[model samples]
Target: MTETHATNPPGAPVFPPGRYGRRREPGRRRPLVPVVLAVLLLAALGLGAVRLYTQYGDPAYDAQVITYTDITDSQVVIDFRVTVPAGGSAVCLLRARSSDSAEVGHEEVTVTARPGERQVTARHRLATSERPFIGEVLRCRAPA
Candidate 1:
């Protein structure tokens, strides 16, 4: 009979050819947490840009004279109403223009209202014949 050496080096593991005794099952499929987070981040960035444009970039200057009483050569006192969407506010800019549509004077005012109807008063000067128009900027919340 041939001699069979029965010696396994320390800390060394040997396994049969067809089976690794421990039978390692397929690893569990990990959840796609990282992918989900990346998608959410991209979506948030898009939404934030939209909000910024609506709030600061696009201001629908809506000027209405509630009361145009005090009138003078240098200044005119006129009470006006400012309207904006609920859950936000509007900043009114009184733009004074020259007869040739040149901006000569501009005054900014802030008005906040709930998610409904809000009425605010503003007074501006009629520096020139370029009739005054109201500019309303809707300030809203950004994406989380």
Candidate 2:
């Protein structure tokens, strides 16, 4: 018995004409489109970041919680420091949370720096309905 082999043409395999619809040719590459889109996306993100920082972030008024003590069922004492523009004042938002991370109390306190003073330490006793596990200074802003 003799073995025979079937030879096919080189290049893409041929299919029944029109059975799979028209074969699409490779399209032109538009490298510029992706580059342009990436540039626009970055520009949009930069603008958004700048807008948010201007609207919500302030370096002139900053607060840090030095310690949280005197935790009790009714209150927590939060000792914090606020840095404000020299001789300026700030309104800070303080918060107390229970062990489960639930906000139990929140308050706004005003801190003032005397002439030539840039930092002021403040202590606030926040009243809560339940026992608080931690306290913090949420944010500080120039008084309106």
For each candidate, the alpha-carbon lDDT, in order, equals 0.54, 0.88
Q: lDDT by residue for model 2 over 1-144, one digit each (tens)?
A: 322223433554766655789767656866998999999999999999999998878667778899999998999999999999888899999999999999999999998889999999999999998999999999999888
Q: What's the lDDT of the predicted structure labeled candidate 2? A: 0.88
How do the residues 42-104 of candidate 1 rate in per-residue lDDT, one tens digit apiece? 999999999999887744434465665444444445567765444457666555444455564
Pairs clashing within candidate 2: none
Candidate 1 regions exceeding 4 Å error are 1-63, 98-102, 114-116, 124-144
Clashes of each: 8, 0
Give lDDT: candidate 2, residue 41: 100
Candidate No. with top lDDT: 2
